[model samples]
Target: MAGDDEFDRWISPIEMTLNTLTNKKVRGNSIVDIPEHLKKSNMKAYKPKVVSIGPLHRKSSRELLYMKEIKWQCMLSLLHRLNPTDDQKVVPPKRLKDCGEVILKYDEAVRACYMDPIELDRHELAQIMLVDGCFLLELLLITNDKQLNGEPKSKFPVKVSKREEFLSDLKLLENQIPLFIIDLLYLKLFGQKSEGIPNIINGYALYLFGCSSGRPIISPNRAHLLELTHWFLTSRQIEAKPDQERSAPETVVELTIDPPDHEHMESMDIWLRERDERDKKVSKETTPKLERCAARLQAAGVKIKTFYGKNRSSSKLEKDPVSVMFGCKEKFEQGVLEIQSLCITEETELQWRNFIAWEQTRSAEKTWEQTGTPATEKKFSQYALLFKGLVCCEYDIELLKSAKVLKVHDENKWSNEKVNKFIHDIAEGIQIDASADPKFCEMINDLNSCDKGCCRFIMFKHCCRILLTKARKFCRYLYRLLMRDYCSTPWQTLGVMAAVLLLFLTIAQTVLAAIAL
Candidate 1:
């Protein structure tokens, strides 16, 4: 495939990836051993993870990367760690080599997979992992007693819990419908991505990490991210590079299951149809649409057959496969949940903790003013915007002080009639004139939203009322943009009388120089 060579190029070798699940045997100086037979096997190491599957492919797949063939020096000891049971001292009657190649299959579409490592109850764990936000695949490596070095590694910050200690069990709920999503909740909230995998998984992770820019920095598309994730899911199925080193150990894939057969699933429509006056249970009437949906699911099938141990009591507790359901609010919530997948975890917390600390410091510095005025104002971050040429070119520090005062008292909340009028007179000069460039109007409108968030935070500092007025004025100015758009009233007409002075000064300077010549 021509696309094969192209696919070969992306999928870049990032400089530092916390080693794949395969090589994780050496934890804290301990050399964990793998099983005997599998240890001598040879395999390839992965390299660029930039996959451009584009928009369509992104929406269609869960974009999981399934594991494949095992190769390592310590396959004998590593296999012991990967066993389904936690009892390392007690080896099962059957050795790992006798179990045949422990094949791994991931639902690239659903983002689900299975692992026997210390045999977790497959059905039970699967339900827990099948949650909304992120479906994680955790590969734990236990170090050999022989390799114990004295030094301890630092702990990770902000731990995200896995369902029953494994994330693959959650894959049973992968929806058939393709989705395009970028989970940025990690950067905003705890700030981190996951570990373990080929180069493809790591690349998709970097893409997710790149979206947290607060400044004028560019952000990548949510759609393409979905595509890259999908490709990573299916990565093991692809052909290996000839030049790739053979001795390099590769993470092995485990078991895979087919998509659930949901044909007999009962629907809400069937549920309502079965409703009888004799039973007459519901005190309140459900919407016709909801009743119908419930009825249909009743006629079709339910995913969960029984609640763990409790006898079912609530009528609302009827079981159904969540992946099949659809609606508007569901989509919105899904967006939120997807972002939540970005939550940093205990394993990889250090990298993101540093990121959060840097952000806070950077924000503080950016808002601080170099000019020694009020101690707070001098240190305020917005002061950076003032000098960087964002606020106003002609309006000096003094006018900005007045503008800020107005932004608070009058703008945030309703202003008294008189003071508001005075500020309107002041802002009149700042309004874009008809002769001014159209770009000026566009830029201010954009700047205007940012100023809104800025003002809200500033209110936190000063008596909230001071900044409140300026914020409100900025807001009212924003609404006026729409008004002007409709009426074609030049901004100068609004309260722009003060602008005449500014205009006069600009022209007089040119005229005076000409006269001097």
Candidate 2:
């Protein structure tokens, strides 16, 4: 009997952790036909030179919670898109896809992006849980100050100090994110595998714990959790343990602010008041110092020229909306960024590079089919050169058209010579056309050589947050042009047809993905 209790207590934390992570409780079936519409339409883009989009929203408290519920509920959700499930904890992005072998490689490289250099066996589940929890707490504190009557919530659902409550919530959030990851791993290794994510991790330990009145499945180990959490929040560049030699540190969510609005401002106040850790060195009434900080924005506002980085060497600004708000009104800017470190090992990096190469190969093949294959002796330009020539991220709305072209060519059999020609054509087209388009020339006239890449990236980036600030600025003009050319078939030809093709392609891609797995 003593042995039974001892054993039950032994694995309770581990079992509960698995259960929470494996919990899938959300479902959303919104049929967004944009992808389908896009593929069917014989899309010819009158690609706008510089379209602005932001300020983009990061995970807000409500949004994060909602995301958690979604992940807990939705069984079909992808691993990379776990923001909602883990209460807005960011996941490492997969570097590449569109090919099985390539994807496997990228999966390795990108996963390494999550390693913690300070720990041994950095891949161990408990260690990841600590950092994951800390990251969630940090995002909440950074995004907005949520004070419930100037207080925070606790994860254990037990009463505690304000700081403790915040810490508890953060821990719960962290546990929620990686709990499933570990469970799924264990289940796949030990449990009976059917297909996809298992219905339950059927390990003997889990089953025994469950059968023993479930008490052993949920015993809390505060001391252990606290020690792990401390290392996560404050550990410096400590080398990883022997087992975690290649592991990276956990990424705390990078919280960006948008232009300030009444609601946003209010939310910020609440978040900060509730989550701020009380320091003995500082007074309890430490009003948030906002003079240096940007403001939170409302919807339909203008994006600012401001860019916030967690550290140096970060991406450029042009993501927030406070500039328009400030220019138009006395609005503040606020945005959130979640920077989750990946488990980037040498192996992982190799995988990503290979995956990227495979993608290039596919794109090249497609170009060849579009035209004719190049001779073996022909030396041609790399399409990556085009990426270097253009601005990156989502700043360029016009480039979506180019991306569409590339997407069309991806996996297709195209001639290298044709691709080389196409590259020249696009470049020549831009060179000749830039001089002709008054707006294009005027917009870039003052920009120096170095600034030129920014211009191209801005022109080519999609209507994503990184580029949306500009895309928003330009999308209206684009929409206006689309409407004016209503009589023209750009929309009709591309829109309807693209939608149909997208559906077919989606089905095809799903099948291919299954085979790869």
lDDT of 1 at 225: 26
* Model 1, span 337-410: residue lDDT tens: 01001111221222222111111222111111221111111111111111223222122222233322112222
Query: Which segments of candidate 2 are over 4 A away from where they belong?
Result: 1-62, 73-113, 116-382, 387-517
| The best candidate in terms of TM-score | 1
lDDT of each: 0.24, 0.26
lDDT of 2 by residue, 1-517 (tens): 9999999855653443322221221101100111222222211111111110000111323423433433222211222232434533444333111112222222212222221221223234332333333333223322222222244222212123433223333222112232223233322222322221112211112222112111112211111221122222222212223332212334322111122345544554554464344233445432211111001110212132322334522222122221111111111223221111112222222222222222222211111221121111000112222222332332221232232212212325433323333333322211111211233223222221112112334323323454565566489888778666652666675775787799999999999999999
Q: lDDT: which candidate is best?
A: 2
Each prediction's TM-score against the native? 0.18, 0.16
